[model samples]
Target: MLREAPAGLPRQAELAATPFFPQERYQCGPAALAMTLGAAGIDVAPEALVPQVYVPEREGSLPPEMLAAGRRNGAFSMTVPPRLDALLAEVAAGNPVLVLQNLSLPWVPLWHYSVVIGYDLDRTELVLRSGTTARTTMALSTFEHTWARSQSWGMVTLAPGRLPRTAQEAPTVAAAVAFEQANGAAAARRVYAAALERWPQDLALLLGLGNSAYAAGNVAAAVDAFRRAVAAHPDSAPALNDLAFALNAMGRRREARAAAQKALSLGGPWQEAVRDTLRSIDAAPRRR
Candidate 1:
């Protein structure tokens, strides 16, 4: 039987009212985001970025064969084309969306992630979530290609009624937020799907789903999810660290180290776990 997604952690709508990072460069993970939701008394299931395995936090090492298998799975197997259609449909309905895109290799250069927070129906432009990039509007035609290279993506809708209580009011958006706060992985996934039906480019939803997959023991699924999250929003520390951990868990020390270092470079509370994992690797004895 397909493992049903878990539920009952904290809601994501509460956090949407105000993003976790006010600094404007960091992106959060589903687990970390859920923790934040918990801090505010909201519940939502935290997902995983990779399959569940006994990863020694103190060593940050994995069995070599596992790494090979993970790499063999590659990045394309995780792409979902239908999801994009749903996302666009949501946007057409005038809902906000967040999409997380990912690249193949860590050393492959370029900013790895981006956020599709909103759309420009009139200008036919995509309002990106680039922290410091002066250019926010990308022609829809241009974005299509950009999105093509992205590995994973998700969408979040606003719950109009839920938002008014928090100073936000969009039914679709509110429903998305309410679904996140509903407290279960299954419900969260449904909400995520609902939001994506119109806006497939939702960062929070992608990250949340990635985290959920990871927790549910789908390591590769989690990695692909986070990869897309990072691709859509380069500065998302949660995605970065989570990806590093996934790599590490698969025993890809070199890639894991690189991912961990990159995550640290991005800088955010979300990097804390990755940083700790890296430190653990440093203290481990090399296999001669």
Candidate 2:
């Protein structure tokens, strides 16, 4: 696999500056998460994340908890694609990937988390910040064996507006929504804006951006996003409904009523919401 590595990715690369944290028994999850969040410029320590991710009875952190902790610290946390090439691609792009492994047999599982910061295709080895080791090297084949046990589960934590090299539209949008839930509208706005740049006509991205902007008190920006969404998908009732709401918020009741009426006429599942929007526009005081 190394012999025919993907083009543009260096055959050998290491993120020497990535921070390392030694795991305190049953705390590999927090330590690995700290290393990943640190690389993304979060500056949080593993000890600080213990309460957020560590599970005392399970003796380890679950994937969802680990991801949530990253989001709580203002990072865009996402699960990497379940493929070795995808994982290495993120590393080559300078994003350290947090991976779960089962060092023991599947029947007698020993779950652990580690950060992969580099890979040497020439030597067929992957470099990691594992346990108490600042740098640990494992044969590519051996690493795959342990990783496969966990179904190749891996994650990448990144600063807002940054994306994994192998990011896909659906998953990226999903992650942005999750980040919004964990963080706030402002953080999610950045993510949605960044994704919109890549996928200009994506309905979900447009809606997310509009919703985030509206939630952040930027009604004008939300209206603009919804307008674009309506242009891209003229028949989208949700888009029209949102635009109407924003327009009403801005005191453009006349324009809001027009948009809401159109949305109600074309409504599918959003019929009720469109009706509500139209009613709100009607109830709004007229500007004398």
**Lowest summed lDDT window (length 10), candidate 2:** 1-10
> Which candidate leads the pack in lDDT?
2
Model 2: CA > 4 A from native: 1-3
- Candidates' C-alpha lDDT: 0.45, 0.92
**In the order shown, what is each candidate's alpha-carbon RMSD?**
22.0, 1.3
- What tens digits encode model 1's per-residue C-alpha lDDT throughout 145-232? 5455544344332331112111112334444443444444533554454444455556766766666666667778778877887788
Whole-model lDDT, candidate 1? 0.45
Full-model lDDT, candidate 2: 0.92
* C-alpha root-mean-square deviation, candidate 2: 1.3
Score residue 6 of candidate 2 by CA lDDT.
Answer: 81
